[model samples]
Target: MNVATDFPLREYNTFGMDVTCARFVQIDSADEIPKMADLFDTPHYILGGGSNTLFTDYYNGTILHPAFGGIEMASQSTPTSEGTSSSSVLLRVAAGEPWENLTNYCREHSLYGLENLTGIPGLVGSAPVQNIGAYGVEVKDCIEKVEGYYTDTMQPFCLTSDDCHFGYRDSIFKHELKGRCFITHVWFRLSPQPRFTLTYKALAQALEGREPTLDSVAETVLAIRNSKLPDITQIGCAGSFFKNPVVDQAQHAALLNRFPDLVAYPTGDGMMKLAAGQLIEKAGWKGRREGDAGIYPKQALVIVNYGNAKPEEICNVYRQVIADVKDLFQVTLTPEVNII
Candidate 1:
């Protein structure tokens, strides 16, 4: 275990908020989990890859980070179906594994199902927490099970996918087990067979002429992401700050009448998910900046820090966006990124 006091967190969180935690502990082994129980005496937060996190100010508490890393093949099966082999592979990825690394691994192994989620940042453990999704695939679609220990009780537990109750960027981790569990591993079921979900319009159009192979699909997904989201390595920003607002069919019809160009997707329950970026862009906030903080011009869904944005600046921009968007669309834009 590595411990530090008054640790700088600028590099830890993607938003690049200049902040510090009272204590920062990174454990490399599950054996240290028991030791962490005492840390709960003081307020503490579990941190992953810091991709989907925004630190609004100094966190005057312990920040526990699990650094254990490994991706092991736990099982594999090949069933013959009318002379055709339906091969499947199961991988157990440690929480500390970079999400991109997992996607890359899939490509290397010719694994299907993670291609569309290629460029998302964060750790594998964090994947189920937010039910991370992109293109046309959500992390829940590939997750077989999640393994972790409840921080409050220090009892290890594993939950099947059905128990996760995943829904549009949400899972048990964010609610039922919120602030109570430290995820240690995630199990994913992948296949060698070539199966693709190009249902998402943009992704489909982008690959119009090209064949949809694993490499091609992953590369295309990354390319599309690069065109919109700011590279976290350079600009300071969470990919998409707001969750795409979902509305009832009646509301969707009302908005569609006023704005024919409105882009939306049906959620199979008369609920239509509106494109948040389009809404923000139409609100005339794109490329707009408040001092150092601004919505990324390429995609209005992102709030970025131009070198040295203060926490208040970021808050100001997003708040104003919500207020303005609400005034115009009557649709509430909620943040997808966790603000701490």
Candidate 2:
């Protein structure tokens, strides 16, 4: 266990906010989990890649960060009596492994199913917590199980996919089990066979008429994400600040009639997911900034810090965006990023 006091967190978080923690602890191995159980008695925060977290103020408590890293094929089942083996392979990935690095590794090794999630920032551990999704694929679809240590019990546990109770950008980890456990690794069930999912319009257009390979699909998703999201390294920002609002059929019809050009996607069972970016753009918030915090010019879904913007200023801008969207469309937008 590596420990520090009054540690700066600008480098740890993608937002590049210069906040300090009272106690910052880094655990590089799973064995270290038990040693820090005592620290859990007080308020503590478990940090992953810091991609989806907004440090709103100085964290007065301890920050536990996992640095464990490794990836390998965990197990394989035998062929069935019909002479066809199960095409799936289970991969055990460490909690601290970079999400993009895992996807790239899968693509290079001919592993399928992770192509649609390329270029998403953060660590593998947080994927299940957020149920990260893009281009019509959610990480929950590929997750077989999540392994973690229960903070309350100080015991390790494994939860299967069904046990996770995953939903749109959510899991038990974000609700019932929030702050009760710390993920140590994830088991992903991937395929060796070629499978392509091109449901999103932009992704389909990018590969128009071209044969989609793992490399091609992954590269296309990366391109699409890059075109819209600001490079966090260059400018501090969380990729998407708000979750797309999903409404019932009647509400959807009412909004559609008002805004003929509204971009909405069917989420089945009489629910429609409206594009938060489109709503923000229509409300005249795109390319708009106040002080040093503002919305990204290209994508209204993103909120960025130009430089040295305080967390309160960013929150103010966020509040205004939500208020404006609600006032104009009668739809409320919820934040996807965790505001700490």
Candidate 3:
């Protein structure tokens, strides 16, 4: 429970940028937050798994770590005329539980719904905040409730599925209400009755036109991720540095005319999803390196901090990519990783 000053953060984030936190505190349980809150006396950022974040510069305030862990299942059922049969089971996960670990746990338990989220490196608490998604499935689809405390008021609250306001890798927790609450736990509704979702192109192709089974989907996703994303252990990188921009139909058509080979997914809401990676590669940025920062060869959307790169160097590359994409496509690429 020691709050250190000017702490080195190179080992804390996936980017491996050597930045120093002005203040740092780590908590292992929710009961400790109240006491820590008193010590904060100032604004702070909650550190989870630190997979989807970039330390552009050192923090000026306290950086708290939510280290809680544990997972529990509860039997849930609804009233019926026939009988009280279990409808769904609630899996309660601590805020600090690694997201990938939770996905693997569900896979091992024969529980469906978390398979598509495989290989996403983050924490249970941060998942809902970003509405983390991959292969056509977002975490919001499986979340039942999110329990957290109001940082300002120091009051605890519970948010149901709808309250999360999840949409396209975003949630209320991220915007409109950012930093207002500190997520402590998350509850998800997973099914033992296999209802797999493997609709994405990569997944479908991996399955070879077969039905979506939990095991197959999970395995396919893991393989795909491993092949695409850089190994954080070897190379410092935050996967998918930029978010795929969703452009309107008019813009999509304009881009299609300019680049006929452009690939996109219909949002079914007068918008089309364009892959940021494809755009980066099309812009001839793939495998490009500048100093210690570089665009990943396999996935241009990722920006890697190769070997002892400073935080500013990584931020420079991000700015360059955004500027280049805007100049070429008239589309602004937004970063998915939290740049702090």
Q: What digit string (tens of lDDT, one per residue) describes model 3 on residues 1-340?
A: 6678999888789888888888888878887775656654586888887888898886888888887888888665554778667456789999988887898788888888889888888788899998989888888889999998887777888999998899898899988668777888999998887787768878888898677788788889989998888999999998888988999999999999999999899888888999999999888889999988999999999999888878788888889889988999999999999988
Off by more than 4 A, model 3:
39-41, 78-86, 209-212
What candidate 2 gets wrong by more than 4 Å, as runs, is 78-85
Which candidate number maximizes lDDT?
2
Question: What lDDT does the true structure give each of the candidates?
Answer: 0.91, 0.92, 0.86
**TM-score, every prediction:** 0.96, 0.97, 0.94
133-198 per-residue lDDT for model 1 (tens digits): 988899899899999888888899999999999999899888989998888999999988899999
Candidate 2 lDDT tens digits, 128-238? 998999998999989999998899988999999999999999999999899999999999999888888899889999999999999999989989988989898888987
What candidate 1 gets wrong by more than 4 Å, as runs, is 81-86
Predictions ranked by TM-score, top down?
Answer: 2, 1, 3
Residue 164 of candidate 1: its Cα lDDT? 94
